[model samples]
Target: MCEACSSATRGFLAAGDCEGLTSLVEEVEFTSHWSYEDDSNNDSTNASNDSVRNRSMVETRVPRYWSWHQQSGEGSFVPSPDLNGWMLTIDAQNLSVGYHYRLCLDVDGVGTMQGYGYTGVKAFVSPVKATDVDLPLPRARDAELQLSCPLGPSGASAFLATSCDTTLPATTRVTSLGEVRTASVPVLSAGSASACSVMLDTAHLPGGRHFTLCVGVAGSGASLGMIGLPALGDALVKVYVTPISAFTSPRGHGVVLLGQNEKLFITCSRCTGSSEVFISSGACFVGLASANSSFKSTPTFASLLLGSSSQWEAVLDTSAMPAGQAYRLCVDLDGHIDSTLGPGDSGQFVRISGVLAVSATGLAASRVTVPLQCSGCSTSTAAYLSSSCSVGPLDVISGPLRDAPVSMALDGMGGFTVTPGISGLELFRHYDLCVDLDGIGTVSESFFSGHSVFLSGLLQVLGFSTVFKAPAQPISLSCSGCIDTSKAYLGLSCGGAGGFAAALGATAKAAPTTVIRTSGTSELLSVDAALLDAGKHYVLCWQQYEQCGPGMV
Candidate 1:
């Protein structure tokens, strides 16, 4: 038997945050303190051993005999190593979590029951789970991600590991740097053991790869420990690393031309964040390639949309940009995402070099440098077109795509060259090229004959890409004092010696063509538009003659 520590020491937490403890005790009224050597011989004053009864706490004694719910049961009352009080453990006891518990102690003395202490005050004991983890694990790359975690007293250091397969190892012990990916610096060690949040550096993580989160203390190996996640953890626990920035459309390199008021639609992937596009002076062959390279003081921000977790798209209105001048265009990520952590190494985006050739005087030799751009289209969709080559409204009667939808594939830059020669535009033809993108939108434009309409468009105005013949281009030549030759005309050819394609246009050389001119006053020739192949350089040739009879009279 043991003495009573206090007559009224109830209402105290019997055990704080107990673990692996189970018990079921009967609820009885607090009346008197009595101890018995035998239930039949209960004389409260003549109790057990006087030596042990004098001590309030008997460390050597293990309290085992007790009744639960007025029934016989076995349990133990021992000092707790983690808390400042005693903990209760029992066998053949039924208890559930989240339920408050109260335990009373009765000991076996002299081979019989002995009532020790009847605490007048009430007490409580709580069963708590050990450690836990939280979720909605965010996707990150080369940036700082704020997170919350429950890290009690023994503070821990957060660690990150990457995996392409998205499969975490069965065991949590990760020793190698390759396995752990990267880790260092303590986490949530700011104070005593507590439930707190922490920050994770999402750097040095490969893009498009899966990652695992972990925490450890005083250990070389970082163990994977996200244990408190909710059900359906498959979607919540899987974390991925995104690229800093990359060009998804217009490819990574090339030349893309744009007309005035036409937009250059760009799509990019940046794990860090968004960015603004700038039009620099002239096209830089080495954009962002050279650190010394500078950009225009002013920048033209494009209309951007975070299309998905992997890609974002933008469209720039070139109306503010000066026409006829080539400008370096590039997509940047550092401009948007916070890069406090080192961005590892690379994050190259889109860069193009090309001329903005707009002509009110018309292309020399009737050849226009056409720059075509397309957006909101899949990589396989295309466009069908037929034109008379005039930079005007689409001629539905002349367009072949009127009956059914057609598709075409544009170059990486969504550009097409318009010239008269091979890989060039046709002489003069009007076209209505149309594309029905992913069934979500349409992207199509027309550039038939004399009216050269090259579309550098986005979304509903754009589609896939393809190479087609150049639309027709009309030309008119003039001279104040010149000779009118009935055999004069216009022709095209690849860049070479004398190897020319046939002439295409209505001219003096054309059969039964009418020529309007006044000898020695003015000479004017109007050539009709004609279709030519796409993506070629053609040399223009003009045929004209004059007969100077013996006029020196």
Candidate 2:
């Protein structure tokens, strides 16, 4: 079997390098960064100025071509642009009607991944994706890792081998009696996935994070890993063996939005012995000036719909859960168990960033926030946020904004603050207090969010505690190394010595930067047409609107 697969391929290198665990191979998809090639590489199918538009200008972008088989016996794929990546089919020379073959992305990371190891945590029948959290092994309990071959026939005895030392095939080591695990398990049927779970003797296994699990099927002798697809590669999985037992799923990017119901599938392998399963929630975060106390919901018992015991699924009906409030997920096994999910972190929770309402009433723009949850969305769905009031440039106040003593002064200690004499400050926008101090002349120094003269910093900052709710918003000054250096507010039109004028000069871009990478004034070169007022003809050019100044012109 090894010779047949070896003859079909050579030098199959894996992609990506995990930071610490160097022995194991990552099982996720290699990222597919896609962009259309220029005219030199165009296949006549390309269109001129082809622009793909979704609902809004935000939240959507083009996708890459999917690669179903970068390494195959003889494969071909039709370009699947709509799917965000290319889609392809593998035409293996050795694939029979009733045999299990390991399919993979070929390499790892973004470098050159080609295949997926026929591996997943042996918890669900569908082989759920592995979590970044290390599979915690209690001092006494044994954890299970799966070895599978979906393209293989029945009666193929499978063996599992885990190792701390890399560079050697566990299948080869097992064949040579090199202390690799060799076990045989039953096969379900033809064309059915032949899977076996080899228990790890925790005592014999080195008690640390970095380890790799290798598997093989015994046919005419044993083939390391899966057959056919990955060519001659072994089914290797990276394991982070830890003394700290933990809940694995729902660990990363727990985005919870408002007006959405979330169902979480909770599983804990070390949690099998407990008779009853319970789920609990708690406020997971608190920042400065937060009044809310640490909150933990009473653990509510849940009836398990499925699972042996440890691997039970607890459905979280978070319909009534507070939006925009991050909450930690807990197993609630204090009285029932001897082991606790020690310092179980946000891997057990979700973050909400949904804004319920944003308004600019009078001189204050108020914001209401909730969760930014996703329903039926995978963790790969990315999110972007820019906190500000106007999409255009700061509405430079023209009029003497207010005729009162809204004086801004360099206090004796160089402290920057906004007191409650709030006059006609813009509502619901973020404003950087542009200032001119001694050495640094006219730089954006102090920044305050949530309703200030520059319409307060931001309406409501995402992932922050309830904003410092007050009439005069507190402006957190970030003037580094500044100590009362003749400060003057730039163009704010307050009774303070600050005033906005033409000296507030040319930024890289003009008012309302329209370009994405708005690095300079050239971004607004988007204008195309100009007509002559005399006969409404296309104007050739325009002369300078003003005369030169002094000798610098």
Residue-level lDDT of model 1, residues 1-553, one tens digit each, is 1243222221111221222223434432234444433332444555565434443532333443322332113354555554456544443124222112334454331223344332433221112112222222233432443343332413344445543112232223343364236543344433444434445555445443445554433322222111111110011223334343444333112223332333344443443333444445433212332333333313334455545554444454343332222344433344423333211212222222222332211222223233344333344333333333222222332232233233333446645332222122231122233322232232222322112232110111012222134222322334322234432233232111111122332222222123456444333334332344345433223322221110000
Quick one: best lDDT, which candidate?
Answer: 1
Candidate 2 residue spans exceeding 4 A from truth: 1-72, 76-89, 93-141, 152-196, 206-208, 222-233, 246-553
The weakest ten consecutive residues by lDDT in model 1 span 224-233
Q: What is the C-alpha lDDT profile of model 2 across 169-255, one tens digit per residue?
A: 323333323334433333234333555444554433333223444332333332222232211122344443432233432322333
lDDT of each: 0.32, 0.28
Q: How high a TM-score does candidate 2 get?
A: 0.23
lDDT of 2 at 113: 31
Q: Report RMSD (Å) for each prediction in the order shown.
A: 23.0, 31.3
